[model samples]
Target: MSKSKKSEFRPNDYVVYPAHGVGQIVSIEKQEVVGIELELFVISFEKDKMTLRVPTNKATEIGMRGLSSPDVISKAMTTLKGKAKVKRAMWSRRAQEYEQKINSGDLIAIAEVVRDLHRTDDQREQSYSERQLYEAALERLTREVAAVNGADEVAAAKQVGDVLISRAAAA
Candidate 1:
């Protein structure tokens, strides 16, 4: 690995994997793969009950990153309070966009997805796919919020929901 590519992650550190939301580095171990010794970060996603091994050298390249800072979290909260932007494009195309945003591991982009897809009780109901995408985006956002705030997922989710509700009332 290049000097700049040195591993910045350590065991027990919480990190965000682009496609997997938040996970902890449970350990760093070495294994022989194809006769080459590779160092891996063993990440455990408690919510999903899954374990992932990512090579240390490739962590940054794969978009695995440390948790978002407090400032970023605040920005995401502000984003949630903004108006929702629903495009007139077809649902399938929009859904693909939302999915990409959620998986991009960009907190602000995920917030945009949440804002765009949020529904108030009085608004027209969401279809099954819409509901699924909304929940996924919401979950991804809440997980990072929870990790950054050192709070439980439920509390983080409530905080996000409150922001959305306030936005709805203001609109």
Candidate 2:
């Protein structure tokens, strides 16, 4: 009761899907969903479960985007290790802005979150919410890095984490 479309994805392509960070074009396939045509791309991650997707053109503008360039990813990774302003403003206010940056899917905006929320090793563990938000930002950032670098998601995440951890210790 459904039709499948030929996939237009190739290996090592970089893509960003707002909340999910960046993922490579792992594979594409067609499946039936409610008696309608559905295409999907299979994406892998080191930190999270693998994900599936359809064509970008057919998607409601989500899923399966090429990863960012190495230079761009580098900037984000480096930026995260830099000093940033931690607004003394109430968290509710800052959180709103953080949410905005994560959703923007712009590497720099996401980087800001990573930089601001980053906790040093000497610092006490982050609050539950802070850790949650940091993971979210890291995942998003790592996804892009993994996709672009052709590295596993977990490795990419560790790379970013190591940098942040070291930066915090030094500060």
Candidate 3:
């Protein structure tokens, strides 16, 4: 890769690479792959006990991005505490749209889904499909928050729940 196009990855950076979810940059190294010299972002995830070495130049190309800013994450938290926006549209249609957003690897979109699907106090039971989407969105959002906040997944999830629950009560 040309120096002009060199990777923006930095050591200790928290990045999300779509398919892999949350991963910590364990190291950056120069290695010869085949006949070319390449820089790699060494990322590790404990849940899968997997280590992925993504070529620096290919980071963005592979949907890798830095963690959201604290302010952005904070906004997402506030959104979670707000009322859900249930579209009266067909469930299958909404599900497809939500799935696309979730797979798009965007934190804000995932947060929107979490906020919109969240069931408040004494609400009717969620449909099976609704529960599935909520879980996926919540998982994705929490993983990114965990990476950005330097907290474990469970802790991050709890943090999200607390924020939303508090806001729900205040409403």
Which model scores highest in lDDT?
1
Query: How does candidate 1 score on lDDT?
Result: 0.94
lDDT of 3 by residue, 1-171 (tens): 455545476878778878767778999999998999998889987667999999988888778888889998988887776677879899899998888878877877788898888887587898999899898989989988887888888999999899878867876
**Which of 2 and 3 is ahead in lDDT?**
3
- Once fitted onto the true fold, the runs of candidate 2 whose alpha carbons sit more than 4 angstroms away are 1-14, 24-55, 58-64
66-118 per-residue lDDT for model 2 (tens digits): 55678888888789888977899998898888888888788878888989988
Best by TM-score: 1
Q: How does candidate 2 score on lDDT?
A: 0.72
Q: What is the TM-score of each predicted model, taking all chains together?
A: 0.96, 0.70, 0.79
**Clash numbers, per candidate:** 0, 9, 0
What is the per-residue lDDT of model 1 for residues 1-171, given as tens digits with 9 covering 90 to 100? 567665589899999999999999999999999999999999999999999999998899999999999999999999999888899999999999999999999999999999998999999999999999899899999999999999999999999989998899899
Superior candidate under TM-score, 1 versus 2: 1
Whole-model Cα lDDT of every candidate shown, in order:
0.94, 0.72, 0.83
